[model samples]
Target chain A: MGDLTPEVQRIAGNLLSQGQVDLVLGWAKAPSNGQSVPACIRQAEQAGRLIFDQYCIHNLATGLLDHRDSSERIGIFVKGCDSRGIVRLAEDGQFPRERLYIVGICCPGMKDQAACDRAASGLFGETAGDSELAGKCRQCAHPNPVIYDELLGDQQPPFLNDVRFSDVQRIEAMGIGERGEFFSQIFSKCIRCYACRNICVACNCRQCIFDETRPQWVGRSTSAADNMMYHAFRAMHVAGRCVECGECERVCPAGLPLMLLNRKLIKDIDQLFGPYEAGLSLEEGARPPLSSYRVEDPDPFVR
Target chain B: MKSFAKSAITVVLDRLAEQTRTYVPMRDGVTSNFSPWSERRASDLALNSLNTTFSPKGIVFPQTERLYDFAVDGQRADISGTHAETGENILFGARACDRKAFAALDQVFLRRGYVDTNYKARRDGLTVIGRDCLQPGPFCFCDSMGVDPMGADGADVLLHETTEEFGWEPLTEKGQALTLRLNDLLTEKELIRPESAGCRLEVNVAGLPEKLRGMFDSPVWDELSTFCMNCGVCTYICPVCHCFDIQVMNNGSSGCRFRCWDSCMYPEYNLMAGGHNPREGKRDRFRNRFLHKLEFFQERYGSFGCSGCGRCLVTCPHSLNMVLVINRLGEVKVDAS
Candidate 1:
């Protein structure tokens, strides 16, 4: 990772100098804590601020939405999961592929900044060490980017313990009432901060349902019912489109088991839609299972 | 000095809980916050942690609260204020920074010739028991914000943590009353007051308010807000970022007006009735937040809006925080127009 920074800087500098990109999105060491945070470099000289490290865990794909309304060509760096975000956005027609210069990194997993923060804050009684890999990275099936104009680093294998749907299976094994109780307990802790929704690349709606005031699709209260509605609506909306980046779970301040909900939907989609994974490619006119209808599609819920 | 042994601290809390709904710093799953204490949650008490993940401000000003109830039938309207009397409550083991935030909140909801009935009701009954922050973390900068880690300005009772016992000092009439209630549990003892150790992270806020007053149009806001994703995590988790929106939920004719936490970072925060937004861009919203914390708050109140508990430092997914903003703002050369 240390050796790859020079190449990243060189490529970003070259892109900016040649005016091939209006902006380069990557990670830079935060001056406050020395932790790698998202950096937007518009000038070739500022490209040196960029760095790639294990602590650069934030999914920069969500940041692309800030420029969606503009015609500025963006040069972005992506990990395996983040590349899926590009696919998610491009497929949704929210962003055009022509406006992007994709720089992909063959991710080797990253450490969780929250864990490092908790440990450093001395707030949690005992927290995971800074060196611990993020829980999301542990379940990653793709360590290499699916799409990129130019790639960095060597490709890597899937993480050791790929129990992607194991947690979903455990929840599925629970009885109906117990599962309801489990979900309610977790949902009750939600503060309605919307960090999970805001951080998700798949949530690219011009006007989110939760924010609609005219119809008020979801109640704003942090009550059990409202929280459930918020999460359930969000999960259903992003069911087949979610790239399994595990970012929603990672950014949740309440520590809710959001991946359980997301992975459960993914597993169901795979079963019903016959082995499908989202954000895997940029096929022309291809749509997620939930987005496009098929004549042979199962309609178990419709009946 | 009246003191209680560290082992008997729970006994003190047990007695306090009998009198009022006691809120204590407790671990909740992956995070810690002030929650109503019970025997079952006694094991989760995190007195020695740097600061709770969430601030204890919700004890007085909740995240959501009903302002009024209204019913409209046949062109006749019946409206009732939902100003229920908040019963006695105790906030135990709050640090100086959090306690200072209560003072900042007090200025907004209680002072300036206008009073919020709901905030006043809850605040009047609330007794704050501020504990000394002996273990300042890497992110803490309360001292830089003019807060003393050893002294809590508005706390009724101050609990000084030592190796074996807590040296309790009653500072107000309310503190005295609580001291009398726990007389049996406490014993007179002489203990060394812990040395006040300030935070490792320090920012010079001197002349910051004055400098920020005229720098609203500074280009620094653009650079600072470049990577900010405009999430509500910082404001919602902040102890003193007390912005809210009043909304109503109507089921046909009967509805209740409620207020919930709102963030300036959101696009809808500044949306006007005419469908025009003043602070429409991320840079505008971001600049307003930093100014409010540094300049506007000081002009409106006497002190800074931020208590510097550094909650945003840890929780912001993008790493955009007050410390970074302050440092960048201080470094930039601006004309004091």
Candidate 2:
């Protein structure tokens, strides 16, 4: 139940009052009980609203993308997943790295919102049980933020295992028709709310293709065929830049397994090209695996 | 009024399903939606646990529906309505919120000047079998907006769920007609009226719709829209979010005009052909969404559009539901000196 909220407030207040940042973005208690939502604090007095806990599931760094060009620096609280979003933003040169003041919090895996709803009656402390944790957190490779301007609690060790990829392998093991049906069923559940796209830090575009109507790509209908095209195209768009944040799947109202496509691409990148982890740091080669490819890369189709 | 045991309730549904295509709450993977009942795909009669996800408004006002088809060229422009497979559909286990939404939709589609034949064709023979919600879900706030989770607003027949039995009260001609068919399945069980759980979250609905009339130019929209993702989840999940866009699917020689669900939250919803979008900012769009639900619909339909199903509470990525909006706006000093 203990979180470093006091510490977070102290740092954010210091940053905002001393003119270190114009805005301090973090999670705050939601209007409802046992829930938290992303908050944007512009004043030092409002800095008290900043919170860090198991309920801080949103990737705040995505919203920070719009504020990148501001004259004054912006302070952001980042988890392992959110910090990766920062790296992805930096890699694309979407924002100046100097403009950000990152306050990283070591995450002890988070729980699913639905599971949290189910457990709301328990009235208990943070429990790190596998069943309670989000699907992404269960197979997380990084519990500590890969990059941060300031670190909060004691760093937790990363649980490095590749069991998550077997999901992609399991799909790969399926016959083509079965795979088609599998994805069709998932995509059909899409309400086309664009929660996955809107919540994504990597899906930073001035105008999303789905929203464009001049030469409309995806029509405004929730048909299964149209939905399939929308997701398939988005997976290709965020292929390499995706930092395994799992925000897409988390934000999905229909509970469609969106990370399956993103992780499948990540798995392909690792196996086909080489082991590649996105958004580790700006110091690491900024280009995502697909953006800057070597000609010597192996190909099963080209042959 | 006659009550039947939990097991015998299936007998009633089975008899109904024998003739009419019964739309029952069935488990659909991670969520539950109304699916047609069959022998293999039985209904999830644990209606308390299984939510409609959104209300059953889609049954009347569908997500996307084709109006008619016209010629690609100007020649032979006879609008041909799609042939609908004619059959009666019964929405079983429909909640009061869902039934209220059906009535609200009826105002728009049936009672309106130009009755929408597309909606009318489907709604004419349709019937609602209502069930009382004992334990309301995390997001339910139906009672605040003049809706009872236990009341039968649009239902022909109302069923009260208890631990051991379901008390049936046939309300309309449809119910009495259907009851005649369930002659053998009927049982003489005691009608137990236990206390029902309704929406916990409260909003001040009195004089509020009128209050919203002058507050369109308010600053509260800015604060609310700051966290708004402009996603259609809220509108789609909403029971009475009935704004839909008219679009035409064009092939070279053939095309079909259809109506698809649109959100006032989207920028394109207000965009003009002449490149003018009045509600351009997220603030404007956000304000419009609640205003339409509270004020505009009240002006037109004599009631607020929202049924308080609370689908938006659980579904919104950010917890920006009507509860928060109502609370924030209610507290806002409209004439800040």
Candidate 3:
């Protein structure tokens, strides 16, 4: 991919200049030094402010939820993984596919610059090299978007060496007892911050079930069992549908291996279901497997 | 139906290995659970053991599954993608209650608004080998839910244990194929039916929809709510609870997003961003839980949401059983016209 700044500017300017889209959504530097965040550029003049690099990690789909009923067509920039969120929203029938223009970039996996800084120092190390990107980026195969109306750079081949579940393999190598202990220790660190949930695009719910007071399923206490239930149940809810974008783990302040839990589900989904992707297509009327039922489905419980 | 002695069942497991991944109950250290068959060892299998510590739902609705991934700089999102390793596996030694529980889950996760292809693929590719429950645990209550312990309603291959012989009945084409593949170890024998295990808990959920509607304001919920610490163990261990939340994470310019499970018991479950909780207290929360399972599910899916597996009885720190609560609710005499 070309320098992210120029590529973002060129794409945004073209979409705006040609009147193909009413607005261009990209990333611009946050007020903090070199920290980039999602931004909406309504005019060609603002395109120069756009920046794309390791700092542009937010799944901008959350921002689009407000625009679902709008009549104007909008152009949005996205990395390969971020496109899955849009695909999911489209699949859910949350938005009209034709109203949006996609400026897909061939991403070369961005880093969790914050985490690298934290590792370098007790708080968040400031001296860590830019090369010390997030683990998700290091293992990313399709850093480039699978679906895009306009491409910003040369299409790179998918990474063949990426092993999706290497972390899961490490955890599975331990004996059952050891594995339990390891998970319990990691789970104990969860303070129920819901940061992982807040940062997840797939977790978009009008009212999260965890917050439902009627049944009182999970308690307010941050005990071991409660924490375990919170994390485990949350992971199960998104099984088979998770795109493995690794945003949940990145926003986690406690640095829990939240991605491992998601990857484990992805692994199981692949193991049980045929190879499936979250959102690489615009085909309407296609259904997800978990939502449909067959009367003859194999039931192991009946005897 | 063909009958064989208990000893002959081991030969069936051995023969099953020739074709597919055969799973049987085995002792892993001190605990006994169903796992993939290792060597051809009869002692490794634990056929009559208690329900596995983890529910068999993982075989269908796995924990920590991916819904999909997408990236968005702003208004546009793209979702077309595929993951590696979607294959097939077999689950052996699933119990009757767990089987019935899947039937209920199938209604929620599969039969609901959006068809989850991930779940459907696993449901399609997997074969369930069920064993009849001769003994019911203290917490077992399948009979109360109108499920027959010995009935082969859900099993692909149903196994019946008898003193003189073990009977294998194929309820579906997949089961028939599996039986045919293992036909080498079988000898044609007469069918011998076993007696049914009587229902352990008696629950009249027939009028529960009306009964619960009138009983919503009843003080009975307050009594049940007192014991609940809101631990969420019951929902986690439950095979049918399917509520969830979606979120997005960003660090600078690039980030991934996801969805995870959520429970109704938490205070934050219904709390909006402005610190407003719709179901404010334990009483309201308690009522909504039962209403969703009994009334809402019936209203939407035409059946009670719960399958009566009784995992909540075993896992609850307070011993608040749903059966006992429902029974008490049933006893609340409301005036009829």
Candidate 4:
């Protein structure tokens, strides 16, 4: 990737100085431990803190949710995966497109900061050698931003040039009982921390079902049944709307393969509702397949 | 001192497993945490790891626990349930930082005239074996938090790891009994203890709690909580975060009251019955979390709530963590008026 730090700094500084944006959401090197982290700057003078690096893995688009209630205009830096999240939020009516000044980057597959920490700690038996492209970046179908007010860096090739549903296919090949056991094993480790839900830009529900108390939808217990319910519900809920950013899987402390469930739904949705990828377009009245309906849509369950 | 060769760790674990439910830090797939000892988990034993991804607090204060069961009958209520009970168990190979967190937990559950029966039951039956940190991890700051990396005050048995052997020093009756149980495996050898290294990370937490008492309305909180996504990652994975929420699982007329781990980061945690939430915003929740850790916990329990185990550092999806929060707090210029 090109050194877009100067460009990012200049854009953020200009946006803040010109009173175009109330906040500039970007990445900064954490002072305590040199790791790149999502940072926000209100003053143009603080624009020097903005950076773009391989370790800048967090999707800043999720940060937009924090300001949805306010009328504050935000200037945000977005990688390819993160840009989809902006579209996801905008399409869901969580954040208006007018409130955002999206600065898009043609992402050159970033590295996972959490994975690096885990590897350095040697707690997971992972050596430094195992560090590579973040799981989300590896599956990137859109390295170039699908929508942007201003684009930066050279356009890059998608990391996943081959079959996008290869991992999903492996799970589909499993016998019914095997598949059940496979998910059960993953769900068993879940502590129900909801990092996946919280980190996700697509999970922009004003009030999540899990957090509902009047008629508590999902059990708070971290039992296999409850965890399975949570994961399955979330997967189906974001079926067509998922940006395939892999933030859900990346943030899961239990190391659950959440993308498998997501990709499975993506594949099924594609098969059921063909050739559809979510958050790719900002066309007026565009909506996810599940969110919008037609008379000719698949009636597999109806029959 | 009773000593055991590094190669005989499985043998030692097997012996302990026969007598009690032993939880050893072991690698599980891509993460490591305390789990029950078994042949399958034996090969994955990770005693040398800085600290497990998940804390062993669940061993005593479980993530979700059944409080009681209730049934509604015509004009009558039937509440019949057993209090939590447990047999003797061993927490083997826990680090000093994690072991220290038990004290904070004990203060919450077993003090001030309101002893939790479930917590008491588990606390009474659990024996801790804390391992010394000869080499502290980059994120570890237990010393700055007033904990000795080499000294685990609350551990029954303290294990000192050297080049090829472990020096076991029993501090309590439980530790002595455990030492006696594994006498055949442990040889009476004097192993040279390695020099302890300090954590690369350090913060001056001196008078921090006292200082934080007057900074409730400070603008620093607004700046500090800016990028915090308000996720439960920090609280859930934290060794010392001990808040919980109670709920009921209803099936027809019968239900069981269960309490699960709750994060103050959630808005509903402080939501009022009258549809008024005192901590409704992310900033309010974030401020409360750090204040609770830095001020309220210290004022109430006479010790910092955080153990500086650094689980939050490694696990927080966003880079918001205790170290950053504390450092930011340190930089705040307070007013005396």
Candidate 5:
């Protein structure tokens, strides 16, 4: 992908200098030339640091929640998936909509950091279908921001794939015992590092269930049992709220196929609740599928 | 000195496993980790992997370890401390960076004024086999961190790999004993090791810890923390981060106390029992994590806590690792100086 540094920096500098926003949230070149990390440009002078490239894999919207209570307006740069995350948070009323100045990017796709490293190519070595882009990006439906104030580049055409949930289906096709083994093995790799939970924008609870001491829902231990419960509970919690950003799976150090569980819920949410997609718009998401349901909604467990 | 053919290392490991448990870098789905030798373990031994996703420290200091078990009967209460295992652990194929990390860990758990007996026993019982990392990973900066990828200071035995053979050099009594046990498999050969190709990334750590003393109020931490996803990957992957949380796991009037790896990046790590949390913001937690690795640990251990394994560089969601912190802080320091 071509570097959009000049335009991104110029726009961010304009916003910062014009006093239009208290902070301009973006990505900057990390010490590793191939990688770009999230950057928060509070001053106009620092806007030169902002850059947009394939290495900007982190969903910057999750970082924006830290500034939710602040009254000052903040300028945030968001890709398609990241824009959906912003809408997820906005639906929960964590960050006020008026305070957010969204600078949306027409994302092609962000490449996987590990794959990029293995490619051994210094920069812009995103080989197509070599598993370079994150699985979410690979199965990406929307490359254009769903919600934004101002657009950066021309809108990207819809990039949805016919086999978006093919991988999820493979898991669904497995027997109950086989699925249990698959997930059991996935949780075995978990170190209880909380990378999956921390990177997720859907996990916005002030006090997490994992941290509770008296009840101790999820032990701090990395035991397979603990890991399994932690993931199962988290999957249900983000059921209707998740925007399929895939940031949770992308951020996991253990390489857990978290989206499989999520995609299953998403499919069920669509199948039973009659076609629901969370975070499509900025407004408080249409009551959600599980939270507000019709009597006619299918109950697979019952029948 | 003894040598074994590269292809025959598994046969050697199988023989070694008969005496004691042998650990090698094994593939787990996508990532590689130093796990106990098993039928499921890849025979290739993941030597091609630059660095394992988790450090070898887990072999010595497991993520979750029971200190003691407590039992409450109908009338009486019983408490029992865990006994140290008899059979020793032979950790083979550790990279020089990991060996250096063990040296750093030695200062924390062995030579410190208050030595932890549990860590000491585990340290004493285990034998480390260091491997020369001929080709450093894309993100490896062990050279910049003053670590030679070919050096084996902490390892009991050193092994250098080539296309044909693995040159084994024993450095300690434990390694000598193991060598003698494997004498049938090993043959006397000239010690020829490969020269490291060096690291792709270079981080200047000269006078870094001292320079970091005055950087308490620096704005760089804010910038770095903005991108930091606040995950424990860096700390867990780090070879020498020894911070742990002690907890009691109770089951129906019976309980067991164990300690698990704790990351400063976590909100709960520094949080007190009271309602107030001092390091509530990600910036403060992130700053503390780096400061501990760069400044605090250096002050206490007289060496930086990082080994430049680059596991964190690859694993971190935002690519936020020690190299990034060191380079960025170094840049700021140079600008100020």
Candidate 6:
């Protein structure tokens, strides 16, 4: 905290003063309380309000969508996760990558609010400190942005965690009947609210296929089959493109183990196609394995 | 590229398991899918096996993922989203069909607007190790798409299964790095060329776009529509189909929004907010699926979207294979020839 506050101020002030950007999008302490929220500051004087800390978990990339068509270039402060979203948006050509200046910050794994609450209730007293972080932060693999124009903090090393497919392995160990029951139970809880789809950065579409009523592809009733269709179909759409950001699972109010569904797909994609990433670099001209036709592809189902 | 005795393939797999999670095709009950490799699991890791009941797209896209989470109190809202950790893993035994599917998905998700950051992160950290397919299955028509059964374009590390020995070739930097780590398990030897097999089906889709355009109003769709249940099993199982929808939800005072998968087979797929449905009928919807695959995706990305994985044939309740549909559609040859 020695020069953090001052450093943020300096960067924000300099960017504004030098006309590097018309607006600096960063986190500022809420005027009413200690909470930090996303702010779009235009003047150098507002730099004093900018803050950077654990509470600054909001993905600033969402704000960029609002400014996509704006003439004024924006300077955004991004955490590792937010930077990925920005990179994805840029890769998709949603906006010009050169238009914005990125201020990246390295992150250590953040806390999980719900997981901490359960752990505290069992062992420690009511006071558990600030053991709560965002759910996505808890399992974050890339706590540092891969691409950034101006990094504010010292670069952190890449995460080297062991591959843990324990949840999927456990499900695989269960009998077929048991596995069916498990998925049935989990899918049965789906209300078709589509909270997962909304939060997904990859899910930015002007008109979604689910909302298309002319085709009547899927029914409006939130029945068990319809919900399953919705979840499974949504997953397939983003298949080979989902980055496993964990935003969909965290937003689920019902606390569904949504990560398991994604993990299962990720595992399968790795097994089927060669290693491919969504937006790291745009070097290869080849399409994703699932979307392209190849004459010699293996298809044992064909007689 | 070095050829090792059939017995040595297991040795390489065992060594891979010591450091990374290794997956191989295995039968879980009646359905076949990729499962983790174990030393005593030789029977489970069936090489050159039948197509799994499910498409392999699950490796990257995932069924459920958190885009970001936001909560609003009064007028203020807080949001949080995170990216996956980066690490190397070996995709032990991928089939060529699924490998081709990755290319199609990449075009739709990665090539189109906003490279999916989440897919990029997970994909970059992965190394695809492919195995050759010796025999074509019932629905196999990858040959019609001009894909090589023993190709290594999509694979970082390719393992060619020969009659007497298995050959391993590293095609990318990631594969080379993985090979360096697995030096203890492998012996350095020259790469052995693989024998190529003839494909089951041969198709000239060069004129497919023009053919489809003329046939849009053809009665062939009536024939195709008779068997279609409109269940979307074909679109759901196809490795390259990428249509989706965005939705917003409110739970009391606070709510979140999402974009989920959407299919063209359903009648409600084209309905707007004011009850306006564009592709209202099954015939139009069916036509859209074909047109998008054979025309639109190709028109946009310079390639047809179908990877010829044939999962659609197995999953479809009526057993509708695109090859047959395309062939039947092509039967009424526009006489332009």
**lDDT by residue for model 4 over A229-269, one digit each (tens)?**
99999988888999988999988887888999888888888
DockQ of each: 0.68, 0.38, 0.02, 0.69, 0.43, 0.02
Q: Provide the clash count, candidate 4.
A: 0
Predicted model with the maximum lDDT? 1
Give lDDT: candidate 5, residue B21: 87
Off by over 4 Å in 6: A1-303, B3-11, B17-19, B36-43, B83-87, B189-194, B247-259, B333-337
What's the interface RMS deviation of candidate 2? 5.8
Q: How would you encode candidate 1's per-residue C-alpha lDDT over B194-227 as one tens digit per residue?
A: 8866788999899999988778888889999987
Q: Give the per-residue lDDT of model 3 (tens digit) for B1-337.
A: 6545676666676667656666676654323345667564556566656565446675566544445555666777665463312565667767777788778778876887887677777788778888777766555667877677777877998888676666777788888888787776666777656676655556778788866767667777775564344435556557677666654433334434444556777666677877777887756776788788888887888767776666565333334557766777777788663
Q: If ranked by lDDT, best first, what sequence of candidates would result?
A: 1, 4, 5, 2, 3, 6
User: For candidate 6, what TM-score does chain B get against the true chain B?
Assistant: 0.87
Instruction: Report the lDDT tens digits of candidate 5 across residue range A1-303.
Output: 456788889989999899999998898876456467777778999988788877677788888778877788999999988999988888877887789889889898877665555334221112224455566687777778989998877777665565767888888899999989988988888888888888889999878888777678878878888888998999999998888888887766666778988988988788778577778776545567787767887766885
Query: Can you list the residue pairs that collide in candidate 4?
Result: none
Total backbone collisions, model 2: 0
- For model 1 chain B, where is the 10-residue window of minimal lDDT? B80-89
TM-score of each: 0.97, 0.93, 0.51, 0.97, 0.93, 0.52
Candidate 6 local lDDT, B158-193, one digit each (tens): 887777766778888988887887776666666555
List where candidate 3 sits over 4 angstroms from the true fold: A1-303, B3-5, B8-35, B39-45, B69-80, B83-86, B247-259, B273-275, B335-337
Reported per model, the fraction of native interface contacts reproduced equals 0.63, 0.33, 0.03, 0.67, 0.44, 0.02
Worst 10 residues of 2 chain B by lDDT: B42-51
Q: How many angstroms is residue B241 displaced in model 4 relative to the true structure, after the best TM-score fit?
A: 0.9
| Clash totals, every prediction | 0, 0, 97, 0, 0, 92
Decoy 2 TM-score against native:
0.93
**RMSD of each candidate?**
1.6, 3.2, 23.6, 1.6, 3.0, 28.3
| Candidate that would win on DockQ | 4
